[model samples]
Target: MKLLQIDSSITAPNSVSRVITAAVVERLRQTHPGLQVIERDIIGAALDHITPVNFPSSHPISALAGDAPEFAAGRATSDAILDEFLAADIVVIGAPMYNFGVPSQLKAWIDRVIVPGKTFSYGPEGVKGLIPGKRVIIAISRGNLYGSDQPTAALEHVETYLRSVFSFVGITNLQFIVAEGVQLGPDARQAALDKALQETSVLKAA
Candidate 1:
């Protein structure tokens, strides 16, 4: 089995999402012996944001017109990113909320993977996802409380956006292990981390 681990936390060693993702991966590894793990740190990679030149719609035109050097490089990076996601049986993402949304680096990675005709398609009835049966586990960290009962729940975009995106691409076997209110205080942070770690410990093997 292949597992693709994507970490986008800029905080690295101190990142709560990173910690949770690592624990989740470790737990999975313990259960699934010989699992091949592929790691991608978007912060370290510095993936470029999507642009007109690198967009899929322009790829054919660029090829016909002789792709610019920069465009060619960008296309290759995007293709490789997409290929990695496609090849993985399980995907684990470390997503730390930035301003209540996903990190820009993670968003850039999402842009590369949500390619039409590759991950999804439009049918006569409506839009349909092409990639199904892949397991996706997201480790989310937020400084503020954003549970459904919390006053700030309306502002929680990290999990909401990811759930929509993955579902759009036909991934139904998705799960999230969240650590929220980390900035409330040291005690709160520890409590949240402990809770999330416990959740990871019980995660079903990929």
Candidate 2:
């Protein structure tokens, strides 16, 4: 079994999403004793943001063009990033809400991995997802309670945006362990984190 554990939080020790993701990865590792885990900290590594100027070949992978060292390096990095996502039997992402959305580092990584030809293909029928049935577990932390029933739910873009993006790529078996109201107070933070951790503990490892 292969597992991809990713943490995108700028704060390593002080991140609630990281705590939840750690618990989830530990639970999975306990269940799958032979699991091969690949860990990535986007913020820690400082992944280069994608730009039009440096974007790798848009053509098929077999037709990789350009001899420029920069383009070669960019294509290699993109391939590695996409390969990590494609090879994972299970994916766990620690997503902390930043200004009602995911952090820029996480978004940059997405820009590379979720490319048109890499993760999905377009046809006359419509956009068809290339990868499906991947078990994805998201650990999310937010300052306020913005659940579906909450008053501020309408303004929420973090989880909603993720759902849309992943669904577009045919990832349907998605589960989220959310620790909301984290900034409310000491008591609330503890309570929310404990609840989210409990959910992670009960997740099915298979």
Candidate 3:
């Protein structure tokens, strides 16, 4: 078994989502001692935006070689990310929801990994998923609780976006463990974390 862990938390040493992600990895490692684990800390090296200097680089038909300028270098980064996604049997991502969506770092990583023809293709049949049959788990942490019908719950674009993107790539098996209301209070925070851990166990069992 192979597992890819992606952590996007800007908080160091005290990220709730990171803790849960680690626990999930530990549990999986215990179950599958021979599993290969690959960890990518997105905060450490974020993706570059589609700037004027790098816009052409992202295109697959760009004229620049892989050894071209550094700032606009896209083929190597895109290939690395794509290879990691392709090699993983399971992908675990620690996503911290910021401002009702995912962090910029996570979004950038998504942009880098989600190549048009590589992950998906739009043909006469409409859209098709190229990378199928992979398990994905997103460990999400948020300062506010959302998802239910209530005034306190805000709209969540992060989870929805991730689901869409992953599904577009042909990964139908997806799970999310959320640690919500962390900034509400200690009790709320603990309760949310506990719920997330419990969900993790359920996922593992499944």
Candidate 4:
């Protein structure tokens, strides 16, 4: 299986989300000895925001390609990102909630992957999902405790937003390992990390 691991956290060795993400990959490698892993670090690469990925390069009807050089360049980057997403069997992402939402770098990566015809298409019935078989696992870290059970759960947008994007593309198999309340105290942070690491280690074999 080809696994794509995306890490967005700027903080490296000390990041809880990165720690969990590594553990998840380790678990997958343990289960499947031949797993091929591809790592994309969003912040590290300094990915740009998306513009136009819907336009085809070889359209027979128009000279749009010659008219827009910017679109051509933008499409190249988008295509590379989309290609990776399409090729992966399992996707592992490090998502750190910043101000109740996903980091801008991660959002930028998400934008580049959502092509109109490639990932999804609008039809008479509804929006159709083109890619539906990949499994997505997210390692999410939050400064405050905000999950389905926390007081500020409603304000949490990182996981919810990612779910919507992946679901829209028909990839609904999602799992999350969360380390919450990291900023509360050192003990709370360590405890959350421990729990998330445990969860990552016990990830189901399939």
The lDDT of each candidate is 0.90, 0.85, 0.80, 0.84
The candidate 1 region of ten consecutive residues with least summed lDDT is: 56-65
Instruction: Residues 109-164, candidate 2: write the lDDT tens digits.
Output: 88776778767889999998888968889999999999999999987888999998
Quote model 1's TM-score: 0.94
For model 2, the superposed segments whose C-alpha errors exceed 4 Å read 53-67
How would the candidate models be sorted by lDDT, starting from the highest?
A: 1, 2, 4, 3
Top TM-score: which candidate number?
1
Give all candidate RMSDs, comma-separated.
1.9, 2.2, 2.7, 2.9
Candidates sorted on TM-score, descending: 1, 2, 4, 3
Per-residue alpha-carbon lDDT of candidate 4 for residues 75-158, written as tens digits (9 for 90 to 100): 566567878898999999999998899989998888766667778888999999888988999999999988788778899998
Any idea what lDDT model 4 has?
0.84
> lDDT of model 1 at residue 200?
97
lDDT agreement of model 2 with the native: 0.85
CA shift of 99, model 1, Å: 0.5
TM-score of 3: 0.88
Q: After superposition, how far is residue 147 of candidate 1 from its true place, in Å?
A: 0.5
Show where candidate 4 strays beyond 4 Å.
Answer: 53-73
lDDT of 4 at 137: 97
Off by over 4 Å in 3: 50-74, 152-154
* Tens digit per residue, CA lDDT, model 1, 1-206: 99999999999789999999999999999989999999999999888788766655323433554567767777777788888999999999999999989999999999888877889888898989989989999999999999999988999999999999999999999999999999999999999999999999998875
- Model 1 gets an lDDT of 0.90
